[model samples]
Target: MSTTTVTSTPNPSVFGQSVTYTATVTGITAGTPPWGDVTFVIAGGPTIGPVTLTQTGVDSGTASVTDSSLAVGSHLVTANFVNSSDPLDNSSGTTIQLVNQAATTTTVTFVPPAPVCGETVTLTAHVAAVPPGSGVPTGTVTFIISADGPTVTGTLDPSGNASVTVPALSVGTHQVAAFYNGDANFAASNSPLTPLAINPASSTTTLTTSPPRRSAVSR
Candidate 1:
């Protein structure tokens, strides 16, 4: 009677990394053959694998093998070995976790410098990219402008840049806030933006709106 099993491994599973776990097998028949066709079953929801082992000598029930980590989490492991041609295999299982932690956290920010009340200013929301290193920026930036009250309706440009068109009905100072719509749960001020009183100066510019991104050409 012999046994074999593995309980843990080093992770980060880089391109060329290997893991090893102990296999404890005891009380073997003096002439009993070593376990063959050994396999491993990691008891978490992740990839599965198995390997073949070469016996050092007869009746030695202990051996070790290297494995590559597939995921991070608690896992129940099983070590399987076959000693008889009858096909009734030997196996064991245990639990462990592969912990993977991210280094960067998400922080929200706003754009357009500062708030400009009583004016149709162009604004954009900024989300600092990941890794916080490369000078290159990626991902689509969202744009949003909200009037403090229902008085003024704000809109955005093709580039998700927002330009306020203080309509005629809205009077007095309207507070405008821009948010990133990149994700459902993601929204923040691109700096507190405001629309000047929809009186004369702003109204004089004419509420210019291009027909949705790409629409019929207008003369």
Candidate 2:
């Protein structure tokens, strides 16, 4: 009979990140190494391959494969050994692999660098997956202004951008920020606080010219 054990590197990996799994078969008699292939299977997931085992010692052999297509969830991984050139019985091993959402960054900006009181302004938020993890982040983003300001939500587009229009901001310095409600493939994130200044509306003046022009014409 033979015993098989399986393990993974970077057990808890991020979505779309590469992971390697290895299986080792042992329990053979001294001076006799096990020979055959090992197949990997994931519960509720896809099957890897029938990778050939490499002889490592007198009684043990190993096989390994790298994969990067697992979704964000906990997976039950199993390795089954198939005996081809040995008299040992087939064996299997099981292990758990965890996948987490990719990290994200959120940024908030406003159109029209300068704004005036009582004018409508558009606030935009952009979300992106952190390095080592790729793909555009989806879902909604919430926009917030200073205390007492309205809270608005906007759905993201294909480019990971969301926008909301805010009308009638009082004249003063207001802090604005955006929070991204992450999707299944990316983690939530918040943008740094940004200060927006809304200056008071421009004042208007009226002037009148009187008899000075008439006196000069008479002269």
Candidate 3:
């Protein structure tokens, strides 16, 4: 009888990264060599060739394969070893691998970086998935003004952008930022703080004094 064990270099692999799977075969019979080929298969994915197993000791051999094109999700990997001399002693083992989605980033911008008091300003947030992964960001983005000011939420559009208009803000320099509540495909992210200066509104006054001196002179 023979026992087969399988393992992956990167158990929790990321999308688009190569993962090496190694299988070790050991024979129960003392002093007997376990010479043969090992085949690897990924459920719902690709299958690797029957690579020749290299003898390491009197009763053990090993085989390996590298795969780089697996979808992002959970998958089952199996390794099978069959020796021609010991057909009845063939063995196989299974393991699970988790492939996670790539990371994402968030950026924010104000239509007018600076604005005066009581002026409307538009705040926009753009969310995108990092390279190695491609998709439009979905979900809601919350825009905040200053540290303890008003907060508003907006849903992402098809272009991965969300915007909200602030009716008015107090006079002073305020910090603006946006937070993206991630969806199923992407992770949550926060944008850097943006400095906004709101200057006080300007006003003008005029006064007119009638020609009282001319009326006194005429009397």
Candidate 4:
């Protein structure tokens, strides 16, 4: 009979982060290294196929696989080892893996960076996962303009960008920021205050014509 043990690196991993699962087989007779394959079965996760085991020692063998698409939750990871020779019996082992939500950063920007009063502008928010984490963040981003100013919310697109159009702003300086409402796989975040200035609209003057021309011609 053979004994199998399973283990995972970075047991507590962030969503979208890569994790490696390894299976070690032992309890082999003297001078006869174990030979066969090992397969990984994960609950609520993808199943990894039969990876041929390699003899790491005189009486032990090892197999490993790496995966990066696990969901954000606890998973029951199992390793099943199959022995090619009839003399040995197949064995299995189990382990636990925890995946947490990834952190995110939010940034806000507006079109017509330098704008004049009475000119419409479009505000955009971008949300991205922190380093070591990958994949676009989903959900809504709420935009606020100055204290007690106008507020709007926009949904995230495939590229993690949300945009909303606002009417002309008053001529002055205003603080703008974006707040990202996180999804199941990512954490919420707020952007730093972005200062914006709106210049005063230009003015135009018109002249009026009088009847003096007609009086001069008569004289």
Candidate 5:
């Protein structure tokens, strides 16, 4: 009988990237030889050519195909040896390929770095995909203050930025963070806490005098 083994290069492939699948066929009987063409197919994907294999050993042959149009996700690849002289000797094998979404990063910034109590502060969240990826990040970003202070949400714009003005914050140091909910092409990410200082609001005093009015009345 004959046995087939299948393998893929770049096991963890990225979307729209090229990948190569190889199939090897070997005969179980020492004197028997496995020859002919091998057909490769990807489950829910494109079907490769039925390439002829070259015999290297007693009954061993190998074939390969390269494809780049597979969609992003897990796919089952199969290789079939259908040219064996005996129908029972024909063998097939299967392997798996994983396609991952693009990586992303999130960042948060404060317009004024430092603010005063009872003053409005602007918070901006920037979401960006790592290199080798296409398109900007979409969806919303949730901004929250450490120590469970407050939470604000903003939708990302075309430029992958979201901004919101927060109400007055208490006087002290605060750690602000942003979370990206992610989209179809990018993964979710969280930004590091950004420290912001809020100083106490200043106070004003007033003074009044009635000496001139009192002197005129007495005269």
Candidate 6:
């Protein structure tokens, strides 16, 4: 009965911290077919990070590693049992353990600055905005158009505001803009009636208002 085991990957705790590691073997063959000894080794991470543990020993051995000594980021670790201990059985990849972890990217900023109607808007990308208890959006997203939509692109600003420019539009209501954050969030722009229209001079007043005609009677 060969030994099989699974070790949980160590967390980096804070970014850029590595620590020593040791795995607890579960099942072992003890003494069976072609028995001599077993060697353990570490692998993954980076050269100065998880790359591999420095501890080496017989079969069913625990690897030594310092995870805090590694940089903050994602890492994949594996423990392998080499045939060094057993001379009769020469092989690799027979016994191995694997695990994965993420340090978590932290840099919360607002993404795609809030979209506006009929105005050029610039958007930035981020995981947080408004801070603590304020503006915070959810999930991955993209922008688009619906009706009389403005120009939108993937390019985002520091605040993740996509730029959209809308030129002068005709009079009448309109959904001048559409926000396609990958989500169908209908941001609307309604053109209010042009505030002041040239009220045509009343015909009754126009004729009388015209330059006083030299009276033919006076001529």
Clashing residue pair totals per candidate (backbone < 3 A) = 14, 0, 0, 0, 0, 37
Q: Put down candidate 1 lDDT per residue, 1-219, tens digits, no spaces.
A: 455655555543221134565454432557665655555665543334445455555655545666543333334556666654435446554545343321211222223333233434343343432231111222343333344443322333343343333323344454545443332212222444545333433324557676667668889
lDDT of 3 by residue, 1-219 (tens): 799999997878766557889999998787887878899999867899698888888989899998867767889999999886767889998889887765778898887776778788898999987765556778999988885458999999999999998887888888988999987656789899978788898888999887655545654
Superposed on all Cα atoms, the candidates' RMSDs to the truth, in angstroms, are 14.8, 4.0, 5.7, 2.3, 6.2, 12.2
Deviation from native of the Cα of residue 132 in model 1, angstroms: 19
Give candidate 5 regions above 4 Å deviation. 1-9, 15-71, 75-97, 132-134, 212-219
TM-scores of all models?
0.37, 0.80, 0.59, 0.92, 0.58, 0.31
**Winner by lDDT between candidate 3 and candidate 2:** 2
Instruction: Please give the lDDT score at residue 197 for candidate 5.
Output: 88
Instruction: Score each candidate by Cα lDDT.
Output: 0.42, 0.89, 0.84, 0.90, 0.84, 0.32
C-alpha lDDT of residue 27 in model 1: 24
After best superposition, candidate 4 residue 20: deviation in angstroms?
0.5
- Provide the global lDDT of candidate 6 against the true structure: 0.32
lDDT of 5 at 184: 61
**Model 6 lDDT, residue 157, Cα:** 48
- Cα error, candidate 6, residue 181 (Å): 9.3
Candidate 3, residue 39: the lDDT equals 93
Error of 5 at 210 (Å): 3.3
Error of 4 at 9 (Å): 1.3
Best first by lDDT, ranked: 4, 2, 5, 3, 1, 6
1-219, model 2: which lDDT tens digit per residue? 889999988889887788889999995577778888999998756798899989999899999988877888999989999889664579999999998999999999988768998788899999988866777888999998996578999999999999999987888989998999988979999999999899899988999887755545654
Runs in model 2 deviating more than 4 A are: 86-88, 131-134, 201-219
Task: Name the best candidate (by TM-score).
Answer: 4
